[model samples]
Target: MKKVIIIGAGLAGSYLATQLPQNYDITIITKASAQDSNSMLAQGGIAASLDPGDNPASHEADTLAAGQHRNKVAAVDQLVHEGPKLIQTLIKQGMPFDHQANGALDFGLEGAHSHHRILHAKGDRTGLALTTFVQSQIEHVHWQENTTAVELLVKNGTCYGVRVRHDPTGTFKTLTADAVVLATGGLGNLFPLTTNDATITGDGIAIAARAGAKMADMAFMQFHPTLLSLHGKCFGLISEAVRGAGAILVDENNTPIMAAVPKKDLAPRDVVARHLTWWRAAGHQTFLDISAIPDFPKRFPGITANLDRHHVPFRTTNRIPIQPGAHFMMGGVQADLAAQTSIKRLFAIGEVACNGVHGANRLASNSLLDCLVSAEEATKVIAALEPAVTPALPQDPTTIVPPKLPSLADLRQAAWHNLGVERTKAQLHDFHTWLAQFNYRDLVPTQLSPKDFTIANLCLCAELIDTAALKEPKSIGAHYIKEVAHESTAS
Candidate 1:
């Protein structure tokens, strides 16, 4: 049997494990339990051309427009075209999707969606529902929890396996496989305020880069326009679906903030985030006015529960204190439609793979569909690959450590200030200098603790993002570089 090791236990990995052929031995390695994934925290629904009035062509056009026409045409085409069939398959297989009183599938709307093609389950708990459903179907796969992959095992330009450490016990082990797939999610944890799960510390991307895997679109990090923020700390995400339900961004005085911007509250995520960044920087508190949306609590029970836990009274007051927070990364190891990366026998799926579907900015609810579609595509190629001999492990000394290590809080703070929503050349240079203090790029230490490894990975990912941001000076999509205005002196 061909052994396959899949990193990450999110929707992509779980779904891929269930779809692979019987000849392949699948093993999933996760940093935490199966539930500790960004997929579980995703409040938005899956986007697909499921509605009678909607079609793949319309979906593709909306995706391209949201991506600023920078998306790979073929990749976008494949994602939209294949999405409906996959959704139908999931539905036929007993996936519980939200339905109207008439027993028809209830299609929701999100920003940039021209049609109500977004599918949800259990109200705002779509991700949780989908993740649990896919995980239930996974069988015949070895599960390794609390295992962090420190490095990818590559020999002669082909990835063969991974070196892992049981995070709690710190026991190291090397697992060799015929094929390795990275289903790890995005790098939202690089910033202080984020909507990402705790396990999403950019480990997969850093490990891939250190393994000499090609990366792409490293600069595009999407900030959600409205995360429930209390005193600058993120409480939780307020899904864009709320905005689609007639909520508007407003100031403390109940004045609409998006009134001047085209599309108003329904503008693309990057555009809305940019506005919120400037608005907050100008010392104004922003809020989401949800008074117009009928039956708020009944429609968004998950959000209502979160607000109740945080003691935010949504029923009496129709406003939600909001701020832009790091939500998703639109970049990672470069992969094709087949989910094949630059390295042979190695694949990247889900948020870890920049397959050009979400070019500059991701369309709302498209990420979940991307995960399922990519996993399906990857299963086909992985099942076809012939088994190969396990490559010999490297004999080099594995104790290379960085000279300087900053505290996790310090690193996150720096990332938030410099690489957050509005980035400038000065900010990028400052962040680059802060990252340069830790000469960790060249040193791939294999003996550090999981916490130390997380720090190192964050540093390396930060440097890559900084470098990419510096390379592209022009503003487009999510990578908005603000120009520092120079005051004219009396000359």
Candidate 2:
């Protein structure tokens, strides 16, 4: 039987695994416990055009607008057109979406959107709910939790499989297959302060880029404006839906600062995040005040509960301090509409793949939709290929040993310092120079290690991010240039 290996057991990988033919021997490698991913951390709902008054065109329009017109039109069209069907599939698989009195889907709205088209589950745990449901339904799939894919085992321009390390056993193993799918999530964790899970260190993008896949738009990152401010560091995310639901962004004086913006509380994420950053730099504390919101508990129980856990009571608290945190990467492994990368026998999906559906910035809640649609599309493409003869698995040589690499924490700090939030030509140029001088020769050991692979990927991703940021002189989306005196200066 032909085998398929999937890296990362997050929403995209898990869903894609389930969609593949049961006859194929499938193995899913997860870096940590199966649930440790940005997908599970997503509290906001998935955007879908299921409303009678809404359609794919509106969804596409909103996504394009949020992406700053840099999104790939064809890819966005496919995602929007296929969104409703995927939502139905998830619903049919026992996803408990919020329902109206008549048993219809209860939709919510977010910024840069013209329609109330986001679908949620109980309160704000839609992603968790969907992931749980998908996990339960995956009957025949083999899951290797706590396993990390260290490198793509490619030879002669075709990907054969991966070298992985099983964390629990501390044993390295080769998992070969007919195809490989890269679903590892975004690079948000590269920043010191982000809402993403710690495992999101741009692993998939880095691996693919090193394996010769084209990368796009690495410069565009999306910062969520309302990450909850904690005493020492920000941890929890304050959902944008709070603003969509009438909560206001106010300064220390409790006056709404976004009141004059055209979209008011409904501006795109980049606009809001930039505004919040500016507010903080000007010696003002930004707050999201939802105390006056009626039935706030029932409406945003997830956010309320999370805040309460942190000893901040949202029900009575008049103001919650806010700041922009590195949230989403708008760039990733370059892929076509079918999720096919430049390399043969490899596919990229979810936040790891720059399908261009998101462009320079992703629309709120459109992420989950991209996962579902792209998984289905990629699976279909994978299914159409005739199975190539199983090449003899590459033998591991006793003489070969894997290279030693930097610790994850060190890499995280390095990336965050140089590439977080804002940039400058000189900073990027210096970063490029420093990166060139860094010794990657130490990364090549005779044998491969997962940590080694992860570090290698991190360096590659950092380089790509720096290179892209330097190339795109104009500040757009989440990319801001501090040294640019005027917006027109770059143009």
Candidate 3:
């Protein structure tokens, strides 16, 4: 049997493992626990056109409109057209999506969507429900928990295997295979305040890039508009679905945050995030009011429980504090429709791969759909592939020892300051210069701790964005740079 090594058992990796049985033998490796991922923290749901009135054409149009027509036409076409079928497949696999009294699927609307097409389950526990359910349906697959992928075993433009460190053993090992699939999640951990899990440290992207894979759209990082600002810990995301379900963004004076915009609370996340960031700079606080949504506690038990855990009291009359924070990444190792990366025998799926499905920004709830659809389609592509002769794995030579660097907290804080919602050319230039000094050489090594590698990936990814921002002065979509701002007085 042909062997395949898959990295990061998140949403896409989990589904792909379940699908690829007869074609090959597969082993799933995750740095964190097998089921732990950004998908678990996903509060909203997947977007799909299951209603008769909502067809793929309409879904495609909504997705295209949200991405400002910057998305790859064919990729978006496939995602909207063929992605919905996975919803039914998942349902057959025991996905517990919400249903109405009439036994119809309960759909909800989000920003930049015309129809109520998002399929959610367990209120705000959509990602958890889908990932958990799909994982439960797996029959036989090799699973490794707490094993971190340190490097891609790419030699002469082909990926042959991976070098991993078993967390418990604290020893490095190499797993050679005919093919390797990278399904690592996003790079949200780069920011001090993000809605992503700690494992999302851009490790997969860095490994691919160092092996000469082509990257695309590094400048387009999307910040969620409603993250509850917290001290000492990660920012808790207030899901956009909250607004879609009748919650309103209001200021201290009870004025709607998006009063000037046509969609009001339903405006695209980039616009809303920029507004909240600038609003705070102007001495104003942002809040989400659930006064319009009836039975808030019963309807959104998860969010209510989260608020309660944080010791924040909420009532229909009380507005929840909110601010913009780093959320989704729209770019990575550029891949094709079949999840094939630039490197031969290597493929990337989920947030780590930039298939151009999301252009400058991604629409809300489209992430989970992208994850499942890419995995399902990639399954067919891999199943038909003839296994290549596995070469003897390369030796891991003793590389240069990296110097003790500054705290990762310093890197994340800088990224949040200069690479957050809005940016300026001058600030980016300075940031890029500072990051260039390290130049990814500070943390590149064969045998290092996972946290150090994670910090390296974050710095490298940030530098990529900073470099792109300098070259492409024109800011479009989430990569917005104000034309001009005051020099010393600007906050």
Candidate 4:
């Protein structure tokens, strides 16, 4: 049996593991425990064409609209067309989906969607439910918890395996395999205010880039309009589904802030979040009023429990404090439709792979769909590739540079201020200069501790974002410039 090594045991890895041919053996590795993935913390449901009168073409059009038509038309077609059938497969396998009182499947609507086509489980706990549901079916695959990949084992222009360290015992070992799959989540933890799993530090992307894998759209990140603002590294999220359910964004005086936008509360996330960003500058605090949803507590048990614990009121007309926070990444290591990266025998899926499905901005709930679709497509390709018996191991690489105790918190704070919901060239340039003092490009591909390697990668990821952001003079989707597109055109 050919052995495949999969890094990051989140939805993409777990789901892809189940999709491979029976003759193949699998090894799924995680940075920490299985629960430390962003997939396990997702709030909104997976979007699909599952409702009556809904179809893949409509879903495709809506997805294109949300992404501002910057999405790859081919990739979006695959996700929209194949996603429903995969959802049905899961449903038939006894996966529980929310149902209406009439026993019909209760499809939910979210930002920028033309129809209510999101399939959720247990309300806002779709991430938790989906990851858990997929993980439950694992049988023969070897699982490695508390293990972190320090580097991709690339030699002769092809990746053969990974060099990882078991955090529990600090044991470093090489896991050779026929193919390597990277499903590491996103870079939310790199920001001060985020709804991403803290364990996500862009390790997968960094390692792939160092191995010469092509990366794209490194600057396009989506900020959720309503993460519960808090003074913690990781904040809670108030799902956008609240607005889709008729909730409204309000000021302290209860005036609707989104009144000027098209579709009002249902405007695309980029527009709504940009509005809220400026609204905050004008002195009125923002909140989401879900009074229209009478059975809010019963429908969203996870959200209600969180709000109650934080002393937030959930009654009619009362508001829950909301602010934009680092939510999702729309770009990553570039991958083809089959999930194959530029590097031979190396694949990237999930949030870590910028496969062009998201384009400039990601549509709500499409991430889970992207995960399943990318994995299924990649599995078909991986099944046909023959595994190499063994390849020449890498020569010993060494770097003697001393570790710099970089302040991660300070970097995150700076990124949020300059590269958050809005940006300008001046801020990005200033940030770039400050960040350049810690550049360690020459020291990579050598022996470095996990903390050192992560700091290096975060700096690299930050530079990529700043450089790309500075180059784009026109505002588009989630990436907003202080100057409008017409102003740039006039200049």
Candidate 5:
């Protein structure tokens, strides 16, 4: 049997492991605990065309609209069409979704959606509930936690395996496999203040890019408009679903700023984020006010509990201060609908693969749905491939110790200053130059440490983002250019 080594034990990797033929030897590697992924922090429900009155066509239209005409029509169609079936599979695998009195799945609304087709579990803890359920059922798969993949092992233009750093053993090892799937999630943590987990540092995207895989649309990063600003290593996310449920974006004086926009509170995330940015620059603090919402606790129990744990009462506080933070990357290892990358034996899914389903901007709740549909499709493709000869594992060196690399704090600062919610041609050009200099001068060639590998990957991914953003002259979606006089005048 051919062995498949999956990197990043998030929803895509874990769910893909289950779908692959059990006969294949599958090992999932995670940087932290199994649940330590951005997926677990996803409070909004999965977007699915499950309602009897709704269908894939409607979902596809909404997704394309949000993507600003940059999404591939066929990819969007496949994702929307495959979404409900995958949701059903999750339900069968013990994912408990909210149900109405008649035993039908209860749906919630989010920004840019034409229908209330988002399926949730327990108010707003859908991602946690789903992750918990999936982990419980995935008993047969081999799990290597506290391990990070440093580089791809490619030979003769084909991917063979991975070079990994096992933190617990304090050593490097090579894991050979017939096939490798990189599901390592987005680069949100690259910024100083983001809703993404600390582990989301673009490892998969960087490793694959270095291995010669083609990346696309990397400039189109999504900045979520409402992450809670807290002082520390951890911060909380205020769900965009709150806006979908009638919450208002207000300035310091509590005046509604987004009321003039189409869909009002339900406008796409880019519009909402820009409004907040403008307000903040105009010497006013911005916040999302959900105080007037009648069923606030019932609709968002997870958020309420999280806020209560921090001693902030939702009912008493009139507004929650927020700003745009890096939330999702719409581009990554360019892939087809089957999740197969340019490389023959390599595949990518979830946030790491730019399957063209999201285009320039992702619709709310579409991320979880993308994970399900792409994972299912990729599993089928991987199962059909012929097994290849396993390559020999790389040996760990004992003679020399690798030098220390920059801290996560340094990386966050660099990314935020250059690649956050807004951009400019001059800033991006300078960033690219700095990155090229760092790579050529600082990074060592051999005996690389985990931190060294991670920082290198981050620099590569950041360069791609900066390069792509510099090329795209228009302000669209979550990506905005400060110097552009008008969005129409750009590009």
Candidate 6:
């Protein structure tokens, strides 16, 4: 049996494992337990044109529009054409989705959709439900929990395996395989306030870049406009479905923030996030006025539960205080439709890999769809690959001593201020200068602890985004740069 190693146990990795041929020996390595992922925290439903009024063409159009037409036409076409069938297959395979009283699949509406085709499972717990369903179906898989993949074991430009650290015990081990799959999620934790799970620290993308893999669209990080904010910190996300259901974003004076913006509450994520950021910068507190949405507790039970846990008086006031938080990364290790990166035998799926399907900004709930479609395509290609052959790995002649790096807290805070929402050239340049102090762009440290490895990975990925942002000074999509702001301020 050919040995296949999969990094990450989230929806992408877990679902990919089940789809791979039974002949392959599969092992899944994750930084935390399977449940601790952005996948499990996802409340947004999956997007598919399941209704009679909806079609793949329309779905593709909406995706392109949301991505600001920056999406790869071919990849978007494939996702739209193939996603519905895959979703239906999952439904037939006992994937429990919410159904109406008429027993029809209950699809919800979200931002940037031309049709009501966002399929949710168990109300607002779609991510948790989907993760549970896929994980329960995985069999004949080896799981390495509490472990971190520190480096890719590549020889002669071909990936054979990975060097991982067991986080708890601090022991290192090399797991060799015929092909390596990177399903690790995005670098949301790079920002101080994010909707991402703490485990998502850009490890996979960092390791890939260090292994000489090509990266793309590294500057387009999406900020969700409605994370529940208390004091100055964000706690949980208020799904876009809430706005689709009838809630409106309002300032402290009860004036609708999006009233003047095109598409208003239904605008693409980038627009809404930018507007929210500007509104806040102008000294206004933003919130989601939920009074228009009837039966909020029933419609958003999960969000309601979290609000209650956080001691918010949403039940009485019908308003949810909100702010934009770094929610998704539209840029990552560049991969193709088959989830193959530029490097051979290295496949990337889910948020970790960018195929231009999401373009510069992701449509609501298309994330789960991308995870499904790409994983299925990757399985077909991986099954046809030959067995692994252990090759002699090269060792570096010089080892640089570790430099004093910023604390993870400090690093996250810096990234949030410098790289968040609207970035200026001055901010990017200064952030790049500070990050240059501990550059690991060329070296993947094997001598560091797991925590240091994470910090190193974050630093490397931050530089990648900083460089990419500096290269493109023009504002486009989620990579909005206030060049004039910097120029005027500098002068």
lDDT of 5 by residue, 52-107 (tens): 99998999989988998789898999899888888887788678999988999898
* Candidate 3 positional error at 298, Å: 1.6
Tens-place lDDT digits, model 4, residues 141-242:
899989998789888778899988888777788889889999998888778888887789988988887788888887789998898764432348999998
Instruction: Please report the candidate that would top lDDT against the real structure.
Output: 1
How well is each residue in 184-277 modelled by candidate 1, as lDDT tens digits? 9999898899999999999999999999999999998999999999977998899999998899999888889989877889889998998888
Model 3 per-residue lDDT tens digits across residues 356-394: 999887988998899988887787767776877767666
lDDT of each: 0.89, 0.81, 0.82, 0.85, 0.82, 0.88
After best superposition, candidate 3 residue 271: deviation in angstroms? 0.3
lDDT of 3 at 156: 81
Clash tally, candidates in order: 0, 4, 0, 0, 0, 0
Q: How many pairs in model 3 have backbone atoms within 3 A of each other, for residues 3 or more apart or on separate chains, i.e. clashes?
A: 0
Give TM-scores for every candidate, taking all chains together and pairing residue i with residue i: 0.97, 0.93, 0.96, 0.96, 0.93, 0.96
Per-residue lDDT, model 4, residue 240, is 90
- Candidate 6 worst ten-residue window by lDDT: 482-491
Q: Cα lDDT for residue 66, model 2?
A: 81
lDDT of 2 by residue, 204-292 (tens): 88777756788999998888888988764786798888887888999878879788777887788777777777777788888898866
* 344 Cα displacement, candidate 6 (Å): 0.9
Measured by TM-score, how close is model 1 to the native structure?
0.97
- What's model 4's overall lDDT? 0.85
